[model samples]
Target chain A: MKVTHAKLLAQVPLLTDLPTELLESLAKSCRFEQVNRGHVIIERHDTTRRFFFLLSGQVRMLDLNRQGQEIALAILDAPTHFGELAVIDSLPRSASVQATTRCEVASISPQDAEKLIYTVPQVSRKIMQNMATVIRNNNLHRQVLQQQSISNRLAAYLLGQLPKDIDPKETVCIRNLPIQYDLSILLGTTRESISRALTTLVDEGLVTKDGKNLYLNDIPGLYQLLEED
Target chain B: MKVTHAKLLAQVPLLTDLPTELLESLAKSCRFEQVNRGHVIIERHDTTRRFFFLLSGQVRMLDLNRQGQEIALAILDAPTHFGELAVIDSLPRSASVQATTRCEVASISPQDAEKLIYTVPQVSRKIMQNMATVIRNNNLHRQVLQQQSISNRLAAYLLGQLPKDIDPKETVCIRNLPIQYDLSILLGTTRESISRALTTLVDEGLVTKDGKNLYLNDIPGLYQLLEED
Candidate 1:
């Protein structure tokens, strides 16, 4: 069981550089959990400081305002870790983490997480790299929000979600987009605004909506919307 | 001169935990600069990867859209560092950094920065803690933006800038507030919206403004605005 857990943890992107011995030790310190869909994995402002690494499935990090409106922050797929910020800083959870789908996760106690960071060079480097990515993405998101139009922001979002290697002129059909409410929250606009943005995209012949999927009819046109007023 | 640089680096909150020997080595690798007000220290998307430690004065991290509109991200005070993200991840500058006042900064080359992070346990730990603070504050800012009201965001921004230990009932005067345009950018609103929000605050008797200063007549009232619709 310990070996199996260690092997599983070794597959995590954040822990890939960690040595086998360290992985075994970490596996010992971690408590594995099987979370059901819609489970509140970590609550906003909760004092618990455990570091969680998702083994499978997906989760969404969000915050609820005083009016109880959910603000979607990000959705995380498996093989990524969360809650390390609170664990490192000893602060309350910055936002709540909810399982968007059933998930398997491994959680480490605060002491174990601290030990790994303080004693292991690779672990600390990995954490810093991961955090740098988060901060950079957050900065980009801020830039998108400041673009001043829901359609522009939505265009940027779609471009970001698609594979980078896809040719600009090539048509691509992206499936399993988040629901309208989640998209609205992520784009920092109302659901009605999102609907209007989609209509605008459809009218411009840049995108075609088919059930849960969206097809890019003109990828360059979507980019043009972001570049123009 | 190296010893002088070491002493200055020692005072930085991020480097305070670093040992004397590491500070000496770091000082050797760092290039110091004296920047005039409005100097662009780091430009957005610049490929240069250098970690900067601010020795004195203030700098604003901002991004400019294609239309050349500025969006202020944060105003970083002295004794803190920036650009570590680019150094750690070898990414382009996430945002531009401009001196808000005459400033002194020490910069480490990408090689030296990487060496420090990889070899120094204390340095890496401190970076993680600092990044954690940045992420938490970013999360809070996102929540503030999601509040969906310019007044609520402005109030939250004011509360964040003020000293936290102040008594809620005691009237307090906060001076040297950012210019209206900068406030507008930081709160994700327009200057007109910020003016209207300020007017709303005054009409509610929660705040009073004098030229460049703001007086909080009812701190709790501002908090209540955040709590209510």
Candidate 2:
């Protein structure tokens, strides 16, 4: 089965707002490539201004913290875009991206991206909306990182993972806990620390795990952890 | 002497790209207000979508960390804008804003702002650029906050304060260190802790302070602090 470039571009959230002709034009100019796991997709401080859209598989966004330790900013899955900031604003890449799995990605030159943004109302508005989301997510990440204790940060992250409108009295089950390795990266702690924190929550009867599903037994108690020092 | 609304709008970085006629139309829809020190300008989770431009004085961006403590995210002086994220994306305010000094500001309805962004290429690009900077700064802030100790975070913050192009061998002086109260808030620590951290840096000969000016006596040594536990 062959997927047309235009079909792939149309699947992107940012380009979905674009009319068919624009998407076709974008499809024509974009360069598509596939790489195996651990291949660097983008390097930190690289000045190349290209917008990348992930069509398949996953990539890890990595940056060095002040301690020169490589920290995972995020694990981005397919049907998403990265490097738009550098393309739109001409800033150097702030973080590096490496394939976590064999991945297919498409990249468009900065000039073409800029032209589409300037001439197309839908594309411009969508760009702003997407950037707004990135800003909001980053702000939330900073708030979560500000938690001084691992368990407190873990509780906050769990609370975030739950549905926003979940009933406080309802016993909710979260089936999508990231694997221990990814959890450690997201939580900025070691695998041992993540285990310890989860145990602390389970021992306190706030959460319970059965096989792959983790149940939030006491939502209020989990919230209370965030208030503690 | 008085400032015309259009004249004020012309001074905003986002609006600088707008032509005079567009600026004038925008000015017609904006409302001006004056707030005294400590007045809450925008409450977090508030649904109101208005773009505010500070004409005078200053405001602090504040949010509650996971521990339920208010942390200062940043401070903005006059001739700046906030709330664009909410205006564009219709998200609830992510953080609150309070006047740090007596302030004058103007706000535009979301419709006018969106209209300008959709119709004006320069304005749209400027908005994206501004959002890009916000995302980058947030990334850096999260990296700094990930440091385990106050002194390490302080050192990272100090390094950030220096000019990016400063010569490594040249001694640099920073006269614009935020007031101790603000620095404490920025570093997520107590004023006493900030004092302790500074004394440690000074006593170690990495920094020297004389009155209001602080000199980076050993830039490389300061960088080394971040690599420590």
Candidate 3:
């Protein structure tokens, strides 16, 4: 998509609630770029000052171990945002983000974003509100992860993926699976362990796995597994 | 301190850069109060619209666990601030703060702070700057804790207590230390482990513990311990 067109569409709540004209101006100040799969978008400790919005495809935010093994911190799908922390704090990126698939992204320099926000009160309010949501969600995830057991963590995470008002008994199909390695990192376990756990669930008729897709066969059974003594 | 005096002192900063009469009016809006040790200053999930500034003594920010354990997240000493997160986000408190020692605090209702800041541009700038500093420090601590090992984390925690720009070789004394249980929670470990580590450090001549006081016998040695395999 052309940078102008992409920026116009980006104003769809995820970017800001600014008017089209304002968003177009903001977009003009930003740069649009495509990154290939396996491209490192951001590097830990790199002091580059850019905020990113995923326009298409996926990016995995990861922290590297001493030996450089990547541990997935989060996965940002299209329409989601990342790199706001650097812009907010004027600090180096805390974690690296790598393209999990060929992706399109919109980039805003920190100075540009700050200038726009200060000059536009509406933009500043919208950005602050967006940041507040991010902070709230991040804090909630940290709390849940710190307190929940591995199984409970996985269950809660899966449940969160469902619609907010969905019936508890509703069977939802999950497709375009997040990689097992990513799941392992999120659960603070090994991919082998995640595979073993999923296998157990499948054998028990709790969930059905077909290739890269999974369907909830028994929601109660999954809950039982989460609550197992 | 008397409420009137505390209110007056709180106005000093807000008034310094504002017109003299405006500062006096803002000061009149503040509410001063003393809270004894163990008093709950702010309750979790409370939407009470008040922000606090520490005048004296210590306060602890805590989150309660399901098992009823109070996880101490931070200690706020004199001249420090708390309750600003709720004010900024216009949300209920996510954590509770209590007086760890008899605390004298000056408070401004969120509405009052908002009014004063809106009327006084200088006050708004100062408050924003203060918030940025607090957020940056909080994020830095979170990153350090997430990335460092237990020993290194402990060492860094101790180092943070010392005066900045002090000679690295200079030893500092920590007196009337809090209980081991408190230290365990702060370091994300158990009391037994903290006791064991302290004993080991003592044996290694890195530190000395006598009664309620700990003397760092060798600052460089403590740093080496943090860098150990």
lDDT score at residue A4, model 1, on the 0-100 scale: 97
Among these predicted structures, which one has the highest lDDT? 1
Residue A200 of candidate 1: its Cα lDDT?
A: 92
Instruction: Kindly list the per-residue Cα lDDT of model 3 for residues B1-229, writing each as its tens digit.
Output: 3445544455444345455455456556667789898999999889986877677888777775433556566776676656756766788887788887898777888887656544444554455445444444544344334433555555656655666577767667877566787676665556887788677778878788889888787888775665553
Clashes of each: 0, 0, 0
Q: What CAPRI grade goes to candidate 3?
A: incorrect
Residue by residue across A9-28, what tens digits does model 1's lDDT show? 98898788777898998999
RMSD of each: 2.6, 2.4, 4.8
So what's the TM-score on candidate 2? Answer: 0.92
Rank the models by TM-score, top first: 2, 1, 3
Q: DockQ numbers for every candidate?
A: 0.56, 0.76, 0.21
The DockQ ranking, best first, is 2, 1, 3
Can you tell me the DockQ of model 3? 0.21
Best by DockQ: 2
Q: On DockQ, who's better, 1 or 3?
A: 1
Locate the minimum summed-lDDT window of 10 residues in model 3 chain B.
B139-148
DockQ pick, better of 2 and 3: 2
In model 2, the Cα lDDT at residue A136 comes to: 76
